[model samples]
Target: MFLRVLGLLICFHVSIVSATELLVEKQAFSIDNFATFNGNVIEEVTVGWESYGELNEEKSNAILITHYFSGTSHAAGKYSPDDPQPGYWDAIIGPGKAIDTNKFFVISSDTLINAGVHDPNVITTGPASINPATGKPYGLNFPVVTIRDFVNVQKALVESLGISKLHAVIGPSMGSMQAIEWATAYPDWVERMVSVIGMAQTDAWTTLALEHWALPIRLDPDWNNGNYYGSTPPLQGLTHSLMLITQQALYPDFINQIQPQHSPLEQAPLNDINASHSAVQWLHVAAAQRATIMDANHILYLVRACQLFLAGHSGSLEEGLSKVKAKSLFLPASSDLLLMPYMARLAHDTLARLGKSTQYAEINGIQGHLDGVYQVQQQAEKIKQFLEN
Candidate 1:
């Protein structure tokens, strides 16, 4: 019943966007049922997104790029040149690059996690934001949102654009979860998929790692069961969480090579001007904590959804794989301990058994999970070859 209403809204929104200009724009729409995986529903769903390139007459030449955690919809390059920070995948989505904006229409959206209060770039309406009705941040009151809910919102956005199908759906890390979900829920919509450095399910070890990341923010006294919006937040907790995440995401060799010799965070660096405390740390605890506090509940919800992921737990891995008729590309970082390359192998093997011709590539880079993001140039070449073939 809820899906029925949401479908109608999507049809209406697509009509509105189709009549307007192409390029990039931001808009809001309604999700009638908002059914979450935990059997909860949001009466009204709000999503923020940005787009690149032009939509074709048939709207079939569409590519969806889902982002990792701590990421926004700003993909390829910035909306304007004067912007302070560049887009996340500026290396690949340019004029003539792979997944070129000159050809395919690319869309990326901000997820439900709102980030923190101090961060100005993140425009999220999460737990720390506010409940329009009560005039306070939802905090603990924000219902738990699953990966399915996140994908459902994105599906609504795409459908609203008259894009009934995709040339490909590509994503890394958490974004891969959304790509996989789309394949399962609406298999007919995607023509091809690329999932990098992610798995069909979060293993127990991965769950433990995420719990550690969440622990620090929750421990802060200012967290106050997520009610400390107007007050000073728990800076220490947020920092600890970031540090833990940093340790997990980065390779030990990369850290060792940079720390003592060139980094400001190294214990030996003190007198040199370039060796200042702020030099090497692109991420600070204060910023991380605020981001965590601002989107604490949303983070919890996303993490929980990731935990619920198992290719076939909702049905069967084989069943889910069968739905994906799209010729798939599964690329997992060779050194990725978190997602692990073997998981991709499992999916590849299953798809093969189901008589689906699939391709698997293990990225041979020491950058760990960062390999998926940093080595886009190499990945893009591989992608170009795949798409061209």
Candidate 2:
């Protein structure tokens, strides 16, 4: 959910910016009685998706781009010429960019509980969605979904389109976790995989760090045990959660450069105990903006999904990874503390030892985990080469 930090960069760079523009529209897909990992069923499920380029007659040229937390299927192009910017990965996903829409049909979709519930462009089913059975928002009654469940829905969508296999499955952060799961869950269906700032499993330390993202939302009085629907939503709790997430996702160096003194230009915090530092104030503004469009329960559900991540949902990571048939590329950011580079490294090494086809690289940047998405252009050439042969 932390991948949205790209907007904070003074200059966003990609391998190449295509001369021509890409225009796209959002679409929807639905599933019936989608079962959850814990044996519950979501009677009906729907998600938003958009794509670039064309699907070849053989359907062998299709590529799937799973989104990170707080992201959607709008992976490239603008819905209208008036848009402020193209999709998140526009740099490497256009006509002549790394993913190359010219040759491959690229598609991305929103996850089951995407955080962009308030964004007009996104359609997702989460706790806030209506429960057909009860005639009320599902709230906490929504079945707990896993990365595996997310993949299963995507698989159903792909099959509905008459595609037997994916040319590749690419994602960043939580997206990476899904990509890895795709490789293992249906080895024959996925031919290639690209995981940026990803790991094979969520360990104890990392899971605890993620739990902090959920704590604030749960502590809010308005949360009301996740049944706040049709009532006052947990705005304060969501804002604080976003604030904590933003702080944890970025690097100290990058933030220090933006606010070295951590104070307002005209005011000194020392003058009043009630005053908050500039960095804290900045977080307040940023987090408040994000919280307006985000749902507290959705964030809580996503945190649970992430914390429960284990590729293939198997007994062990090695056993799970051993099922992969896809040629894989691991691209962990050099400075990411959220999901350290070593996690990706360990996954890559495990695949190598298992005699699987795999490659590893690092994207260097100051955004820490955010770099996996914002600075991913650094590895565009490598991504292009890997996708080619």
Candidate 3:
């Protein structure tokens, strides 16, 4: 009886290990030296990324997981047993989960502009960081980038892994932007696609929100014209930026769940009250929350890139969207004020008219734009059923 009980326990553990969790891993890839976009030619580039599951013999089962503005490559499950935060989408990507590892392999990559200005743990190469050749941060000198540029880099990464094509490219918010771009930019590279709470073009309201988020950072005296590095860096600037963004990215419904009675700011008192109290207090908490965890410069870079995204920048919206040949799934969030559903509705109609296989579903959740993230379970199940069908 004892031996039988031990055997049963061992079998359960193996099953859990093989079918419940992903063995997430990381790798470095090099991009082509002359990858050009938006009228700029990058000589060479290296992108950092993480992968969940194993690529099959044919590499056709690969699923690309693009991340949002402040997100890293860590998509689902814990990086390590001692890691504090579970994978960003702990509920979704896992063995035997909605995006079942037993059937599909998953890959998520960190963008070039990653966390922090001076943090060594973050392997990011961006405008704010020093140019290895010049011994100076790229600063304002960094060449402007666009959504298409991001897709180009990802393509390089995918090719490096010997993946001739992708089964699906899926992401939430900013990631959704990349996913959409991937479908159009390299139609032959993907078989299917999914985008959550995003649109081909950013609305004016969305651009205004982004501008406001950048305002406080720009107003801070410590900004030092984007040259602050060694000394007291732009803590005030970054903090204010984070605070504004935190407030903007959230819906009243979502915040109400985390802090029922008051805002995250109201919970704490003003530190003896000063002229800079309103900005400092709120921005301080916001900065601290995102500071070490993410790079301010990277956030600004991605957001600025997002503002430049226009589905038809290369041609007419109809012509540009017509480039996509992959079957698509569009999940627009209900109450998303930033990328309004109207735009997504337009995209669906445009694609349908273009003769591409496309489907659009407005997810019914209280998360506003964040329905793409917070409601992943329902979203994942929907996707699972769709993909299976």
Candidate 4:
């Protein structure tokens, strides 16, 4: 009996390991002279993407998962168990998790001008890519893109995969913007959607906030008007910009708890700014570390794109939203100051008033905007239920 029980335990362990072993693959698609919203054209554009699970014969179970700013197509599973971290949404995507890889075919892709282009895991067409016309880096020459442009690119990718209908479209933060755009742009194609910590339009406050993210990079001498491709990148300015973003990305209370003794701004008389022992130092270290691996031009472009985001660019918000035929779910973080729960609330209220099929819930967590991904488990069951319904 003891030997039989031990054998069963070994089999269980092996099954668990096999279940969590996920393979992330990168694929690319190209289009010639893709038109931009700004009326300009990219002579040649490539989109990078990854997929999980298998598409059934009917192809009716395909779900599109969009990425947030600074995110890649790696949304679930691990390249290796020893990896520092799994894909951003590993907690809620797997064989039996919220997204349920066994039941749905999951697909995610890197956005054009994606911020993590410097990272090996991501591929993007941005300032770093050489211009077909000049045989040099586009630098600032790359045409400005919009959320709609992103949606259009993904739409092409979807059609390329022979998928005519999406089981669902889901995302958080910037990804949510894409999901919302998909619903508005192709209402008949999407069956349902989950938009978390996002807005239908870039409000005045959000626009100002995005400007701050770009201001520091613009001030960097090495930025050289977005033409600094071969020279030393603007590490200092990028670091400062990321530092500013970090403060708003996470809850202040959470930061305080982590570094209780370090004040963010405690100055000493007759001392250099660097001589202070404050949480600002920690923020600087963290930001500087990240800035080392991210491109300044990419961040600037993405920020500009975010500033121009509107659910309905060519028409009124009501007119645009009224086009959505999919049942929707909105999950706003209770403590999210960056995106703010109110934005989600407004979308929810609008949909409710329209008598559209919708549900609204706030994710209660201490991580603020980061909670959408970091604390996703808290709402995983609810998400599973919604997806199943």
Please give the CA lDDT of all the candidate structures.
0.66, 0.88, 0.68, 0.82
Candidate 3 to native Cα RMSD, angstroms: 8.2
Q: Write model 4 residue lDDT over 234-280, tens digit each, in one string.
A: 98998898878877777888777777887545665126754746566
lDDT of 2: 0.88
Per-structure clash totals for the candidates: 7, 1, 2, 0
- Residues 190-299, model 2: lDDT tens digits: 99999999898999999999999999898999999998987899999988988888877888888888776664554667788788887788888878887888889999
Candidate 3: tens digits of C-alpha lDDT, residues 28-75 = 776545445657655556667777778999888999988777666767
lDDT of 1 by residue, 1-389 (tens): 00001122223323322121123445455556667667865555665677778889988788898877655676556544454334556667656777777787888877765343334444455566557668877778878766677777888888888889988888888887777777777788878888877676666777787787788878988778777677876666766666566556656665454445454356635666555364235345334433543445555655666777765347777787777777778888887766778877888888889887688887766656766665655677878776656
Model 1 regions lying over 4 Å from their true place: 1-33, 114-119, 262-294
Best by TM-score: 2
In model 3, what lDDT does residue 129 have? Answer: 59
C-alpha TM-score for every candidate:
0.83, 0.96, 0.86, 0.92
lDDT of 4: 0.82
Off by over 4 Å in 3: 1-20, 32-34, 115-122, 263-286
